[model samples]
Target: MSTDTSSEQRIQLRLGSEAATEELARKLASALDEGCVVGLSGRLGAGKTVFCRGLAEGRGVDPREVSSPSFVYLQSYEGDSGPFHHADLYRLGSMDDAAIEEAIDGTGLQHVLGAAGLAAVEWWEFYRGPVPQKLVTVEIAVENPEYRSIELKFAGQGLQRALDAVS
Candidate 1:
């Protein structure tokens, strides 16, 4: 955990195994509140779904029920306190003018954001424009088959406090 010169609190964790990654995800889940949006960016097989599973588990949902929504676009699950929406936009193209318009209207993200609960969006960079201003971004990089580097950043003061507590 480190705070840069800009007062941006950045946390980096080395996940030695998938379990470690899941534990980190659970920690993140603890920091989340109702209506929280977690934006995730990573390459293929970067354990985004695994982290989401942990998040679901932390929310009292069965982790076994969580899966990548790449083909389906999004999946909604009943959480401990509210609903959880997991969205994947890997099928969508870049967020160009036309794409952004489509995403803003047709992607169903606006509805998810409007609803209460934890909304985790994978490939969030594609729809970066319409996401909430207080986005909590998580970037995961796979170093090996069993190792990952997870970086977290919060864009708002309240979220920064949550990150601090979790870190």
Candidate 2:
């Protein structure tokens, strides 16, 4: 993996395969602490769920148990380190801010945000609510069928450790 030094709190990685993507995510997961929120932004089929699966495996949960919570909106798993909350906001696409907040509340996503565990939200661009203090935004760009470019922006204090771990 390669890292870009454009920003201290930001790092870019080029993943050549699905396993590489998952491995990078697993490294980040190991460095994350409780109450951390990871927002994932990528086009459909960009491997957001795959990264989450790696996060689950890193946290000592069965990777097989990780899946996209598109219909249910939110799914929680018990991990060895702590809880893992996964949310998909694709269904709330283009909603107004107020409606998005309401949907977040209605779907129990509000509870997961900044909660006591590692939270990974897919299609996080749709949410406009209050962002947690411990937030990491990951934008994955699909370069080809088997390659992806991922940029991670760490917004929380002391998040450099996570970035360092990924590198």
Candidate 3:
């Protein structure tokens, strides 16, 4: 793992297996505070959902209950800390910004993001709408079938603290 805590701070981790990725995500989740927003960007089969599952587990939710909300666009779970919201925007990639905004609003994503809980959105690059101020972005780069390079950027002090703790 490598970290840069400069003005544009970020943490990068090399995960050699799916389990490692999930474990890292769980640690991050545990360190995060409520009302934090996490945006995940990665290619298909990049373990985004796996990370979400770990995140849910860290928040005291059943990991098996967390899945990619690709079809439904969003899913919500009650966790020990608070509500955990998962959103997927892969299907909206081709849509224009306005349409994407409409879809987000229609799915109640706008309301859930940065609410009194943790919100994670997969394929977050597809959404061009205004994002929550308390946001953390994770970019997973596939190094191979079983390995991934994960980079995280924080946009809030709470998120930075969370990253520090996780790192």
Candidate 4:
């Protein structure tokens, strides 16, 4: 495991394999408190859903039950701490500001954004503006077919503590 803390409120990790990526997700899950939001940014096939599975596993949910919410938009499951909400906005392509706001309102994303539980949003760039202020941003870069570089950023005390613990 490798960690870097050079950037302000950021942690970068070099994951050698899928297992390593999942392990890092599990570690982050262990440190997250209620009402935490994890924004995931990455291209297709970057293991975003796999990382979410690890997160669900760490939160005492069945990892196998965690899947990408690409078509449905969001999926909710009972976690050890509380509710775990997962959202994928990849399918909502090219939306105007009004459409985005309407989608946020119609899907109850606004509620999830502020809810007292853990939430992970894939393709978070689509709705970045409404995400909670205290956010943990995870950006995954594909170094190879099986390798990934993940960058995490946050300023909340809970997330900072998680970073410190994992580091």
Candidate 5:
């Protein structure tokens, strides 16, 4: 697990519906611009992608374009705000040194952090390597359509806006 919680700030949220989950996504996306990365983790059927749909909608992109990149690896969506990079690292296993290098050096995933308005990584905790130092990691735990828990962890900051949105 590459999730270094030492410097990260976390907030827990209770979602009453799908809209609530998306609302949280939108609020977080609104706070991010260039040089930002967001990580997401949860169980199967945890509404991770569904939350991404909300984030894409919040960023003014077609929500349908926010599907998981498990197959393609990376999915980019452009909107009036900017580009949204949705990446699924679940299948890739550990992000080796080369992968981490890509994540920071513009030639790889890090390019998304430097350029995209929002970079949402799913199954992020599963990746064994350095996560983007400054990131907003969202963990979704769902019980049903109207009952869910969402935890927002800022890699090195607080998420007041996101908390206010879901509260």
Candidate 6:
């Protein structure tokens, strides 16, 4: 996997295989704090799950327990700074008002923000845009047989600190 510099200054990481992506995720997990919403974008086989594995591990979660919750739609891991919520919004049946209200409300945004240091959302189109202004977005793109590109963009304070940690 290879990378290219983006005009937006987003750090692009090329992950060459699932393991590599997972490692990158782990690195990212270590830099997280409360109230962080990580927006993930990628296609199937884009290493989203592998990346998340690293994230869980970085958060001090047992990597053995990490799995894509595409079926259950959401999974929680505790052991890191705080609970880590891995949410897969791909299966939301509807994008209407009620569906979102149900999913986000029941999940309790405040509770999540307060308790979950990092919230990683896979297939983030489900967000319906207008993510919190403080969100940090990461876009993944496959570059080659073993390479995946990770681009990070931020919208709040402490971005440089996060970048320094990631770098």
What's the TM-score of each model vs. the native? 0.86, 0.92, 0.93, 0.90, 0.77, 0.80
Cα lDDT of model 6 by residue, 8-120, tens digit: 23676666677877777777778766767777778877777777777788888888887778776678878647778787777653568677757766655434542446777
- Ranked by TM-score from best down, the candidates are 3, 2, 4, 1, 6, 5
Per-candidate local distance difference test: 0.77, 0.87, 0.86, 0.80, 0.71, 0.69
lDDT of 5 at 46: 89
Worst 10 residues of 4 by lDDT: 1-10
Ranking by lDDT: 2, 3, 4, 1, 5, 6
- Ranked by TM-score, the better of candidates 4 and 5 is 4
Best by lDDT: 2
* Count of clashes, each model: 0, 0, 0, 1, 1, 4
Per-model RMSD to reference: 3.0, 3.4, 2.8, 3.4, 5.5, 4.9
Question: What is the alpha-carbon lDDT of model 1 when measured against the actual structure?
Answer: 0.77
C-alpha lDDT (0 to 100) for residue 164 of candidate 6? 60
Displacement of the residue 59 alpha carbon in candidate 1, Å: 1.3
Q: What's model 3's lDDT at 91?
A: 92
Q: Model 2 Cα displacement at 94 (Å)?
A: 4.4
lDDT of 5 by residue, 1-167 (tens): 23343465568878888777887787777766465777789987788888888888878898876777777667888877988888877765656756644543432565665464777778877544455656777888877756888888765434444434444
- Look at candidate 5 and give me any clashing residue pairs: 103-110
lDDT of 1 by residue, 1-167 (tens): 44431344678888899888888787777677777778888998898889888888767788899999877778899978678888887877554767765765676778887368888888877774554745678899989898898998776445654686557
Report model 4's TM-score to 2 decimal places. Answer: 0.90
**Residue 143 error for model 2, in Å?**
0.6
Q: What local lDDT does model 3 show for residue 70? A: 87
Instruction: Decide which is better by lDDT, 3 or 4.
Output: 3
